[model samples]
Target: MAKNTVIGFLGSTLDASKRDSSRWQKWRPTIGLCMQQDLRVDRLILLHGEKHESLARFITQDIASVSPETSVEPHRINFDDAWDFEEVYTELLDFAQGFPFDPEHEDYLVHITTGTHVAQICLFLLTEARFIPGKLLQTQPRRGQPDPSGSWNAIDLDLSRYDSIAQRFAASSRESTSFLKGGIETRNAAFNTIIDEIEQVATRSSAPLLLMGPTGAGKSLLARRIYELKAEKHQLSGPFVEVNCATLKGDNAMSALFGHRKGAFTGAVADRAGLLRSADGGMLFLDEIGELGLDEQAMILRAIEEKRFLPMGSDKEASSKFQLIAGTNLNLIDAVASGAFRDDLFARLNLWTFHLPGLADRKEDIEPNIDYELERYAAAEDTRVTFNKEARERYLAFATGPNAIWSGNFRDLSASITRMATLSPDGRIDRKTVDMEVARLQRLWTSDRGDDDDTQLSAILGAERLTRIDPFDRAQLSEVVKVCRHSASLSAAGRDLFAVSRQSRSSTNDADRLRKYLMKFGLSFDEVRAR
Candidate 1:
């Protein structure tokens, strides 16, 4: 087969004075560079802001004047007119679909102007929709004064890194739902831990595995990462199939998983291989497993247990040895108790359950995650952007502060970082940007925390106060708690908490403080030790 490539260009518009013209000049050259590197530039879709039609015409004319060989088409959709995310994404997806690329032969190049939130979201959705391969190019203004001649300013970008960026975005988006705020830090541990476990299970587990976690804890990422890891580790020879249980309600769930023959149902026009069959000898990830109907759950249970399932209207049983990874946020034990989920099925799944800790639980990871996000955004913008030290400190403080209970976890973080990165000038994020985000988060937290009564509020406040005390006192209390919990003797507790090998004057004072503090809190030394 001949090596053919398709290039896609998506940007707001060149006419917008707010956009750096020097940055805009980089597009054609970047495309030209890619072409020189053996990448064929086929379709260019120009996404515009307000005054889309005129801007599109101007850009098209500009490209024609510069390079008569290149054909650029304007996808005339005004982002300003977009009332909702769905509308913007849909328009972008439709335009992207129009790119004339033979998927069988050509690789795609997707270029965006400065990682805008709309652009980022559209890119993520496009990947999820599977319209085009996940790829992106970021163009930035080149340093130095413009040439005295009418030549366009220079811009630098790396074309080859698109695929890698897309993969990272896909992985992050998959794990977005699992974290309070989606970003490199929040998803890192969850992604790494899940990938490790999935690999182990794929190679070692005989029975089907169940992934249990709260909503947005990244079950889907885990599932996909598992598939990739397993494919590499076990040399699996089949495709990874994913089915969202929430989308496949009623009898459609059965047909989607276990394909039906022609005339099996109202829409069954032809025979099709079910996801299970397609995933044979590979992996099938069932997302939102709790949403499946009882009958569907029964069918899934049988398939998992017997490795065989009959399609609707077909008596013949189809055999599939696909590894099952079912994901759900529901309390499966409660579901079983309530008879919503089968006890036997729950038992089978419980054996391999892995709970993902929410973002609030991993406070230490927030700063590192933010740093990672800034770097990603900077790279995508083709700029050397860094967070102001004050902004970084403020963000870390907010993340670890009482206000951070990001229910959406990593997804929220991803959105926030993307916004900050796009809006910041030359990628210099400031405290105001951080303040806006913090205020938004605080409002959300306030609304949620309002559900709790005074008693709960007081208890939480007390805990927060304790956490803010001096490091020495905190360390002493922690040591006392640890010794009390593990050591069998009082001498051990005194020695460990006070760092004294034997009881002494200084040790007694330390013990007294510990005792007094415990009493102040209406607890005995034993209770304080118990922690």
Candidate 2:
């Protein structure tokens, strides 16, 4: 491998008048670099202006006297004004780009010690960005003693090995993930990983995020949380404006999202700043974006790409600089194929798409979410509710069981908790409350099945047996069958079912009694078990 080359601008310290017999009195940075025994500076590219030509020549000779092996090459660059950051940065960038670099054979070092602060910062940025594949070299002046030769150090700008920095990043990642989760301790590893990546993206990116999932799967909730995280991080300043695109109708959709001039439509009585404008410098969450009309889709495309759009009935364009987070339950790719959604808009938002899992898919998270829901209810109702140990377990068993059909995902869970908390006597949900809740959930799941043969009822009693059951007794029997399906055996189900009723009986034959009852419904252990 070839030795590294040092590049830096010549300072006034290289001038003959600034030179001294005692090197410690005024040790210039450039001289310090050449005198370093361990540094292998094969070639030095000294940048100089018209007035610094003499100084550059003197430095070259001085460097030769100190370190003869290092080759010095002076390059003159004109600057309209060195103090102007824009001019200096542009000139330096152009120079670095034009320079012939043999990356495989040579390494590069940018000496940041011998330039104006602006120039130093530009060089650091260039090196850090890898525009110039180099490390930054800094020279620290010695304060005391016989050695003012000073100390030289190189920085690569990558601090991956620093434990504090790594820990900080890990902590921030956890915090961001928690923010997106609404502080719920989500147990789904895949969902947590996705949230972690989203947090990282929210922290560093302004690109459009497309959250695709079924309704009630927390897409809207996660989008709002992302906006809040960005705001808290100081990445965004304006309000988080949200709009359900599915609710937007007719010409109002355009006016609501892209603003409208007065008289744009019959109902457009006044000029309006749309959701996009209101979200300026912040985040705009357009939920159910797949519901937008084609014209609105095209307008959204323009707004996302150009950050400008023409308002309805307006001749001029309006600008709104906002980060966008779009949500939808519809498959945009399918919609695009069907000519219902714009292909271009889908492509743009597809850059960072995350699919939130439904409640059924994340059963492990139900326990924590149950607590979260209860806490939310307490906050809203100003009454804390606690579930008895067995009540909580009973609820979780049914919730995470195969019989549960959470069509409404989190919405259903939240509603369930709200109802239980509202009705809990003395703020305590007992076994009776849990039983009622379970029965209600079963009814809901059964109703949601909508005459399907593969429903929880059919799965327990078999489709043929369900057809013979009376409509009046179907709801009551369905709950019984659900318990039977969850039990380890028919005897276990009978004992639990007749725990109170058996006390009225002179003799207890719970299993035999339950078998005879199931026989009345034309169902048997063999048939229900097969189902």
Candidate 3:
């Protein structure tokens, strides 16, 4: 028997023949026929169109009489009540999301009756949404009888139709594979070399890989692209599971990665499968790998090296075999030296490593990324928006300017473009709006930098230095002056020609030395302080 087949039944519930007792006489035989063929139906979802109270009651009674063993779940939906296209789509999406069909379990059977034009469209969208895989079991009105209930006989739907529907739906969901979708388009020489090496390593060995890069440098995106390319070329058969390790810190982290037995802990009232098991025979991406604690790191290493691990509190080992792709921003070498990370595990994962360059290093790609984002946001908003030549130039001028740090890299650029598109006046963005955004961002960025710098400076100056300075120490001091003229006050004269604020303090010893030197130059505290 085929393992993954979904049977869908489509008909109207309002037909008068359905209310007739004779209809059940015919439907009962069809149900018995299905049972005799050893077709095991676990559950049935009864979908009806708007305000068909009579039809709904008839369907409820008919399903009960025909298939008493099957659990029938009913969902009542109407599309005409929706305000707009997005609202209609969202309502349908919500319904699809509520499906209890498990991909690993028994096949789903969707029974749709009381068909309307909008209802048909919803069904089509549901298929394309890839929420469940099922075949249609539609009952059309029979000739001469002029009604489905009077003369209709249940017939198994064609599997080819279902397959065709699924293929088309999948295609619609993934409309394109290009740079616009955070996919690799034209590979640079360096990146191409890295990709080649990664492919070679992944093909030759089963060892996991560690991809190191700053945030928004496209580490996760690149990992997915690599998986797609490898799966296509090597015919690897499995799903790719990506998890952000940073979000999975502390105790909940372990159970999230590894399966847990029933009553393993407080929340483990029932047995739960972990992502690793779910990702079996596929790829598991652990992004922000550096955030993992030492103990969690050890557990991950064991799984990687041994291909097996004991779920929390389980004596029996669970075996999981899959390729690992780890990503992080920290320098593992430094982390290991500082005793913040496991050296052995680092070496194990470092067998194959790829470092993604920041967007600043690839300025050539910025314009293309911006253009792609513009088109993407426009499509998503269902608006016909475009950047004029002047606006594009203005955007680029500020993006590549000296003041642009863009520490968040591609994510920052994407967000900036989205804001411009949303806030553009008369569908046109100007330089003033761009400048205002930049300035606002700059102030926020500088404030964060100032806090970090102050902490570092205070640590270096020591508690004693901080106490005597009064309002003087709060002023910005040059790194060289802070180190060389450690004990001077603001009254220093001509020793260091660099401009010093009145609130600048060198150190007590430097202050005395500076005073003596200033006296020799016929300068005093009042004279230097006044200057």
Candidate 4:
């Protein structure tokens, strides 16, 4: 038994034609809507121009006389031209925003048959978007009969209630998710889910985003892809400006990010628009944002909240409304506890955080990523490169293996493909090239390990036993010892240290292998732990 409310424009021609008592016989859309069978309009909100004030009052009285229980309320919303889409839409939008609509206690209907075509379309859009929270009411006069009260139909615009349209939207959403992932058709369920969520958030919000991951883990690439997607949708009108916060420092950092007036400092020869201003109306990506100094952190927080900041040596404040996407490998919670990061800024950026896992964590995805990297190399070099069947299988086996640490994530894979393609003979990578690449990768990963520096082993080895060992043995043993110290037990330490080599063995005995390996140096797991 909720009351029904109708909102519409006053029909100047139809509603104004009535002056005498017999004028009620003429068909009018507004009056006709309230007179429909079994329809009780408890309230009517009418929109009219200033010139149509008298006409609007006359119709209100006529409707009151015909339907005593119904209350007619007239609202004046005037614009210069009836056909001005911008003006009409803006006026209607303002009305819809300011009006105290009670949709819970009353059902609402927007009468679309009375306004101009532009106004009608705007009202339809508003109702469809739920800005007005109503269904559409379209009325027309009866054709054969001299029916004064026209027939009316209420149209529902909720798209989700329609399966065909919902399916189309679902397909488009999948495409957007794939686009965000660079169209690689990645198979990792976790990464794919993250991409899908990122697409949804990016499309609906302009809030700050936090991307936490290790260096070279595709943070910069992902940020750029997001910017491109938003630009395609016309969400951003300005340029995408990226800055490496790790490289910014001291007074120069302030000047570079917030700009400065002429004679602001010694190097201020001209007025400069900083990175924030350059990104106005678009996005600003701050990579390694944890590296920013405390002073700069304070400034960034103010600018993000207020869209205004005082530049270096300037009295006037500058304004730049930009979306922020912050990237960091550092654990900002630890930084905040250590007094190196601001908790307030962290709270703001932490609202939408996405952690991108390293390439080592998602081995199943390595095959597809390898194919993607090879395609990238071919495109960049203007020459196609393909691996022989045997070589392809060999490379794929090693890549998906535990030994492929991928310390630099996608960056390492990309560079490895670039090297092999460049070194390939006649655009064909064979077994020989694969073998050479495998050996090179082993050396490279060993050198990039946790304890590549041999000197660190001297404390336990007494500087005498260390000299007797080769650099290769020293690097391997150092990494093993470091892992042991961090691990809770001998077996757990062995699992981590032997994660790569255990795959090749016929039988897995990580603890036994580690114990025997330590025995070669006249040491025990207990002895290593004592250090």
Please, what are the lDDT tens digits per residue for candidate 1 over residues 326-419? 8888888888888888887787777787776666666766677677666777678776667799988877776777556677776667667887
Best by lDDT: 4
Worst 10 residues of 2 by lDDT: 461-470
RMSD of each: 22.1, 8.7, 21.1, 9.2
Q: How do the residues 64-144 of candidate 2 rate in per-residue lDDT, one tens digit apiece?
A: 988899999999988878889999999999999999988788888999888788888999998988889878888866777
- TM-scores of the candidates in the order shown: 0.48, 0.81, 0.51, 0.72
Off by over 4 Å in 3: 1-189, 195-206, 451-531
- For residues 1-531, what per-residue lDDT tens digits would candidate 3 score against the true structure? 324333332245334354455664443322332233245445656554566556656655665665566665556766565335565557767777786656665665443333555555565566645654554344333445433243223323443457777788556433333422354343455655665566567656667889998898888877787677557657456789999988987668989988789888888888867888877877899998888889888988999888888788688889878889999998989999998889999999888888977777667667777777877887898764566777678668667654456678888888888888788746767766665556554544445467554343344443223322333333433332342344354534333443453237654354566556445434455443433
Off by over 4 Å in 2: 1-4, 13-16, 19-24, 36-43, 84-87, 94-108, 144-148, 452-531
Between candidates 1 and 4, name the one with more favorable lDDT: 4
- Residues 413-470 of candidate 4 have per-residue lDDT tens digits of 8888888889995999988887777666655664677444444465566543554566
Candidate 1 global CA lDDT score: 0.62
On a 0 to 100 scale, what is the lDDT of residue 139 in model 3?
Answer: 36
